[model samples]
Target chain A: MSTVSHNEITVTGLSIGYRHKKKEVVIASDLDFKVLKGQLTAIVGRNGIGKSTLLRTLARIQPALSGIIQIKGTPLTAYRNLAWAKITSLVLTEPIASKNLTVFELIALGRQPYTNWIGTLTASDTHKINEVIDRLTLNTIAHRKCFELSDGQLQRVLIARALAQDTQIILLDEPTSHLDLHHKVSILKLLKKIAQETQKTILFTSHEIELAIQLCDKMLLMGSDGFPFGTPRHLTDTGAFDKLFPHESVTFNSETQTFQVRD
Target chain B: MNEKKSYRLPFFLLTLVLVVGFLVNISWGSIHIPFEETLNALLGRPTETDSWQYIIWNYRIPKGLTAILVGAGLALSGLLMQTLFRNPLAGPFVLGISSGASLGTALLIMGASFFSGVLTQGLIGDISITVAASIGSFLVLFVVMTMASKVRDTMALLIIGLMFGSISAAIVSVLSYFSSAERLQRFVFWSFGSVGDLSWPQLTLLLTMILLGSILSILSIKVLNTLLLGEQYAQSMGIDMKKSRFILIVATGLLAGSITAFAGPIAFVGLAVPHLTRQLFNTSDHRILVPAVLLCGAILMLFCDLLAQLPGSAKVLPINAVTSLFGAPVVIWLLVRKQKMVF
Candidate 1:
C-alpha cells in the first residue's frame, strides 16, 4: 500500500494502560496502527476495554506505557504543550460546569491557543468563530446561554469549538453518546463532512458501532487480542468485526454492518 | 453588542451606591460629622472644627477605607475560590484562613496568659492582636497551598480545607476553655470582626495586599474564565492547571489572610458578592465579573458598615453580625428564586 503523507498518526510497539502506584497494568500492548488524516475514525469496543485509555494516551493527556507514536512525521512527544494544543484538540466526556457563558463565548474559548493574554478575540479570531458558527448552523442561538441549549445544539457547539481551535486533528470521546438516533446520525455526518471539507483527521470513541460503520471512513476496533485498524468495509470483509465480541448471544452481521442478538 | 451595552447601567448604579455608601459611613460614626463637613474633610479642606477634621482624617477615613478594602478583597478571593472549586458555596474562608486567624487570636488572648510572665518579660511586648491573627491565617494558608499543589480533585481541596477548619476550631475551643473571662471576652470581641479600629499604617498594608491580590486575579482572568468550564476542559485547552491553580490559591490566600488579619474574619462578603454580581450581570465572563464583583463588594461592605453604625446612634453592631444578617437572607432568596443553581 502506498503511504500517504496525510493522516499519518503512526503507533509502533505501543503499550497503554493504567499506571497504579509503581506498576503499569497493561490494557493493550504491541499495538501498531496509523490514523489517516482527512478521515473520520471511530474507536469501538466493549466497556472497560481501554478505549478511553487509548484516546487519552493518543491525545497526550496521559503517557503511553512504552513505544513510539508519531503525529505527521514527527514524534508526538516532540511537540510542546502549546504547540500540541494548536495541532490537536480533544473533547472529553466531562460536562462544562458553568452555564452563564453564551454559545458565542464558549465557542470563542476555542481560540485560547491563539488569543492574547486576557483571551480577548481579535478580528481574525472573531471571523473564524463566526465562520465555524455559520458552518455549524449555530448563528440562530449563538447569543443564547449554554444552559438554554439542547444537548444536540450543545454538542454541535462543542464541535464548532474544536473547529474554531483550528487544529489539524480533533479527538472526541463519545460525542454522540447522549443523543437520539437522529442526532447521532447527524453528528457523525457532520464530523464526516468536517473531515472532508477541512482535510483534518476526526476520531472519536463510541458504542454506536452500527452508526459508526455507516458513516466512519475508518474504524479502530480495540479488542482483547489486538487492535484492527482499517475501513469499515475492509474490516468487515476480513471478518474482523465478527471476531470483535467472541460471543454467541450477540452476532455481527457483515451484510448489514450491525450487531444483532441471536434468536 | 447590545447585551454588552446593558452591563453599563448596573455598573453605573453600583458606582453610585459605592459613592453614597462611602459618604454615609464617613458622615455618621458615633460622633456624627455633617455630610458637608465629611465631604470637606475628604477633600482635605479645613472643617468647621479641628476635631471634626481629626475625627474624619484619623478615624473615619481609615475605617471606611478599611471597609472597602476588606469587602473587595474578601469578595474577590471568594470569587476565585468558587471558580476554582466549581462549588457555589466555596468562599474565602473555605480554605480555613479565617479559622486559622481565629486560632491565632485565641492562642494569644487565651494562651498568652499561661506564658505571660516569660513572653512579656522578653520578646512579646505590645503584640497587637491583629498581628497575631495574621500570623495564624498565614500559617494555615501556607499549609493549604502546600496541599493544593498535591491534589488534583478540587473536592479533595475543599475537604482538606474543611479538615483544617475543624482542627483549628478544636484548638480554639480548647484554648477558650482554659482562658480567664477577660481574655475570653477579648478573643470573642476579636472574633466578632472589626473594620473600624485599624490605624492608617495597618490600613495601608491591607490596601497594598488587596491591590496586589486583585492585580494577580486580573492577570488570571483567562484562567479564571476557562476554569468555569471545569478542569479537564481547561487542561485540554492548554491551561497549565497546576501552575494556574497554585497562582489562584496564592492570590486567594493573600487576600483572605490579609483581610482576616485586619477585619477579624469578616464573613459572607466573600461568599455573597460574587453571586450578586452574577445575578446582576447575568454573565460569567471573568473580565466583567471580576471588576463588577469587586465594585459591588465595595458598595455592599460600605453599606453594611454604615448600617452597623446604626444611623444617628452611638451604638455599633459587630461587623460580622451585620454581614451575616444581611447577606444570608439575600443568598437564601437567590437560591430559592433561581432554583437552578449554576455554581
Candidate 2:
C-alpha cells in the first residue's frame, strides 16, 4: 500500500435537495462533517431519512443547493468529469445488465478515466486490476459472466471495480443491502480490512445500526428532524440514540448496544 | 468456451453462402449468360462476345454491389437504433425518416404533371428522385435531433419518431391522390425498393456515405460499451454524455437516411440482423458485434436479391418482399423464445 497523504473530504454548510423549475425541496441543510483519512464511516438512518441524498450530494452525483464540498482543500465543483472520476468512485444500488461481460471486463471499467481513446488498458492498469481482484478473492470466478453470479458475489464484483479505480475516496450506497447475514458480515469485514491496509477512506450507508456501531470508526445518524455525526461511543453518551426512535414503542439498550421494544 | 467458438463458424459459412448467392445472381437474367462467361467477364479476361460484356458491366455488376452496400447499411443502422433506444423492436423505419423521403418522392411525381417543363429538365433527369429523397431525409433528421434534446426517455423518442413517420405518410397519401398514372407507377415502384434501379454514380455515392458512417460507429465502440450500463453510469466513466449521444444519433441518421433514400424503405434487415449476429457470434462486444452484423447483413441482402430474380420467371418480386419473408420468421422465433433483449 502507498503511504497515506493528506486524505480528507470536508463538507460545510451543505444544503441538499432537488430543484425543478423554480421551486426547491430541501432535504437537509447546514450539514457539516469531515471524514478523516484511513477510516471506515457508516451513515445510518431509517427509510426516507435523507441518507442516500446526503451521500449523493457528497459524491457530487447530484447538485447541492448551497455550501461547498472540498477534497484536500480544493473545491469539488472545480474538477471536470475526468479529474473528478479519478478522485472519487461510486457504487450505485441498481443492478446493471451484464450481457456478455465477465467479472474481469466489468472490473476493467473502473479504469475508464485512465484509458486512451481506443479504450485499451495499459500494463499498469492491468496489474492494478489483477491486484484488486486477487485482494478481493475474486480470482476463481474472474472469467465468469456477472449474470451467472449470485447477488452477494455481484456486489463484491462492483466493489472490486471501485477498488480498481484506485481513488482516494470510495462511496457506496447500501453496499450490503442484498446480501445474506454471513455475506454481509464478510463484506463489511473486507471493507474494514481494505480501509486499514490500503489507508483509503471508505464511506457507505446501511440500516444495520448494530453492526455499524460495532464495526465503524465513526457513525453519522440521520433522523427526521436533523442529523448528528460522531463516534458511536460519543453519540451514545450524548443520548443521540434516544431521539432516533419514537418514545412510545422502542428504546435504545445502552448495555447491549441494540434497540429493544418496551414491555 | 469452445462452444462459443463453434457458434461463430456459421457466420463464416454465411459469408460463403453470400458469395455463392452473388455469383448465382450474376448468372441468371434476361441475357441468359452462362456462369463461366460471367466469371470471365468479371475477371477482365477476353469474353467470346461483346454483348455479354455490356450485360455484365452495365447491369449485373452495379446491381450486385448495390445489394451488398444497402444490406450492410440498413442492418448496421438498425443495430445502432436498437442499442440507442434499448428496445428490441426499434428499427430505421421507426424514426419516420423513410416516410419523409417517400413524401418528397410523392411531391416530385405529383408536381411533374402540373408543371412539366420545370420538373422534366434537370442536371440529371432520372437522378432528381435520389437527390430529393436525400433532402427529405436531412430535413427529418434535423427535426428529430432537436426533439431529442428536450426528451430524455427512450420510449418517448420512439413515439415521437413514429408520429413523425405518420405525419409524412399522411402528406404522401395526399400527393398520391393527385399524381398522374404514369408518375404514380414510377413512385410506387421506387417505394417497393430494388438494387436494379441504382446507376453507377448513385452506387458510388451510397458506398462512400455508408462506409464513412459505419467507420465512425466502429470507432465509437468504447462509448457504446459503457452506454450499455446506462447514461448515468456512462457519464461517471468520464464520457461526455451529450456529445456521445449527438454523434451516435447523427451517425445513425446518416446511415439509415441514405439507405432509405437510395433503396425504398427496405425493412427488417435493420430490425433483425443485429439479433441474428448476436446469436451467431454469442458476444456483446461492439468491436465484434459491429463487423459480424455488417457481414451478416451483406449475406442476407445478397440472398434476398437472389431470391428476387425468381429463377425462370419473367416477373420479378420486389426486394422488400423477399427480405421480409426471410426476416419476419426469425423475429417471431426470437419473441416466442422470450430471449432477453438487452440494449
Docking class of 2: acceptable
Taking the tens digit of each residue's C-alpha lDDT, what string does model 2 give over B27-70?
88766788999999989997899989988888888888888888
DockQ, 0 to 1 scale, candidate 1: 0.57
List candidate 1 segments past 4 Å from native.
A2-4, A246-248, B1-6, B113-116, B120-127, B335-343
| lDDT per residue (tens digit) for residues B209-270 in model 1 | 99899999999999988887888777778888899988998899889998898888888899
lDDT of 2 by residue, A30-112 (tens): 88878888889998877877889988887877789999888877888888989888878888787774446778888888888
Query: Which interface RMSD values do the candidates have, in the order shown?
Result: 2.3, 3.9
Extract clashing residue pairs from model 2. none
Task: For each of the candidates, give the backbone clash count.
Answer: 2, 0
CAPRI tier of model 1: medium
Question: TM-score of each model's B chain?
Answer: 0.95, 0.90
